[model samples]
Target chain A: MSASAGSEQILHENTLYAEPVFHVGQFPITNSIISSWIVVLLVLVLAWSLRGKIKSVPRGLQNGLEMVFETFFGIFDSITGSRKRTLQFSPFVMAFFFFVLLNNWLGLFPGFGSIGQIVVEDGHKLFIPYLRGATADLNTTLALATIAVVVSHIAGVIAIGWWKYLNRFLNFKVLWEIPQKVIKEPTILLINPIKFFVGIIEIISELAKVASLSFRLFGNIFAGEVLLASMSAILAFGLPLPFMFLEVIVGLIQAIIFAILVLIYLHIATAAEEH
Target chain B: MESLVSIFHIDGKLFLAQLINFAIIFFVLYKFAFKPIAKIMQERTTTIEKSLDDAKAVAKKLAETGLEQTRVLNEAKKDALAIVEKANQAAEVNKQKLIEKTKLEVAAIMAGEKVKIAQEKEESLKEMKQEIAGLVILAVGKVIKEKMTDDKDKKLIAEIISR
Candidate 1:
């Protein structure tokens, strides 16, 4: 009987339980995907419903939406210092704000991550689930970061010349000094390789931007989810409520940070090079 | 050999899937959400500023009108005072002329009365001298007539005796 009990303990730990959603040939659809799609649909429906309802005198959701836009525009205007710039980039920034805000808030719903079923595939039972917050997934954060960084560079290329942006990577001005250092200090040949390697390192740093932005957001949110999960599992009664509220606040803050970081990156990328 | 699970793991497929999802979202959002709404917000800002400018202009006009009204009121007050002063001056001149005319009429009446009195006194004096001369002549004539009548009676008696 003790052997059976020990085996059951091993079974519980080794199951590798995950919320098995639909699989498209090993690319499993997750609850987080479902939540993101739901957010997309909800945003679409909301925009459609409010379309053409705009008036000289605002009423209902129009007033509320205008107030929010006005507030954010004021903040962005302060940052950008030109109404034209604010207007130009406001759509991208506001989209980030709403999508992230909705995703974060929806994570707080009851049974978001909890409600799932166990499904068996290839002699293994995995926990299949319906809903998870998108930001909690590393994939989602990385993709968002990639889009932000890539789009910012695109904007920079459009703002400044492409050659200037390329120079930031290649740094060809040091080429003239290479011969001087080679003759005076023969050890400079070794240093030149380091400099060449440093250019590659610059490329890696750009890749690191993707990793840092993604991990920062994912770490905070995933940690919050785990904290709530553990709290609920330990107490099962009333102790989890405060932590639940705290997770809600954390989720919102993470979403805001992600969006604002993206905006900052865009601002930096698009700024004119100083002489 | 022992194997430990790594806490940091990258799911490449999941990342690709998310990248596709984000790309679609960004495109859809740019098309549907960004264009019209941003334009509307910009227009709203312009409208608010325009209203504020209109209010400022109206206030400036009101202030100007208030100043002009005060100027007109002061002008009307000056005109009224000028009219009153002119009327007072004319009344003073008329009163002086009336006093002078009254004095001249009194003087003319006094001169006319003095002339009449002098003419009456001269006539009365002439009448008194004529009366006195007439009385003296009457006395002389009475005495001479009585002496002549006696002498003529004596002479007539002598002439009758001579004839």
Candidate 2:
């Protein structure tokens, strides 16, 4: 292949992070933020338009949306084992799923990565677009994960009392029970400390949950974006099409995984321990 | 950590904005979409259940009414049968009484007619005996005028009349 002078300027490479589109004061508004705002607007408009048309006997878009809600609620119910808890957690979990999924799939559109401005930085030209996959950025996923975990704790505090919910992580109640249970069973002295250690492990696990939830979604989406970019770079026409389809499935899976995990966390947090 | 931050360009501002975006979606969806739809579905379920229950109740009532109707019809039939039987018994008694009354009237009328006939027969017999005596007297007188009075003949005539 000969060096084509015209194709060189149009060639855009995928970056590891979202490039900044503009800045508001000290805050740099990245391309991912713009994409997220667009998703938010889309969700809001859909919700608003459907708000008036929500009938008892659902029809058209209401029916489709209800089916989606029912299917997702059923999955949530399976995780939570209670419709009450599913209802409580569904708003955020569904929001996260739709938002992440939309952001992921929207990135595969025609103008997302291709159309951008070339700017010279350190004498090397870099292509920066006005929009990118919101979930491809670490911050968006981190924020979603943080919100999910935090909301689970809040739900826990409300479901069980505050002290009881806190005891899952810092179990002074278990430590205090050691003396009381020692006289009755005599094996609790050995079991109680291990239980206390598990509580500490529980705290560590909560943090791990946040990290894993954020990273898994971020890594998957980012990888898919990179893969699509690479494929497009290789052939740009027929080769990227199949990968784009694959990315859609991947995007849906990742969204479901994230939502289900959050639902599980909510279920666990709200459940009252028998002991 | 600095390399990771620089490479990924992790912005706290963007994270906050995304969080706000999510919060807006959550509230909006919960208020406008999920809540109303769920409420409507629940209401529809309750209404359907209520309708089913009402139908069941109506069916049960219909069955009960059917049983009642049969019971009432049976009672009416029994009453009608009893009335018919009573009427038949009364009619039989009335017929018997009418026959007895007619027999008594006929017997009284026949007894009166028989008594009247016997009286008339007695009167006629007495009159015939007197006529016979008158004829005997006339014959005896004639015989006396013709011949001298005989004691023996007069005694015999008296004996015949007495016998």
lDDT of 1 by residue, A25-86 (tens): 97777778778778888877776766777666767876777787788778787777777887
Q: How well is candidate 2 docked (DockQ)?
A: 0.55
Docking class of 2: medium
lDDT of 1 by residue, B1-163 (tens): 0121223334566668667766656656666556656667668879999999999999999999999999999999999999999999999999999999999999999999999999989888777655644553456457665444546544554464446
Proportion of native contacts kept per candidate: 0.32, 0.83
Clash pairs (backbone) in predicted model 2 = none
* Tens digit of per-residue lDDT, candidate 2, span A192-243: 8898889899999999999999999999998988898888878987998889
The root-mean-square deviation over C-alpha atoms between each candidate and the true structure, in angstroms, is: 8.3, 5.1
DockQ of 1: 0.27
Candidate 2 at B146: error in angstroms?
Answer: 18
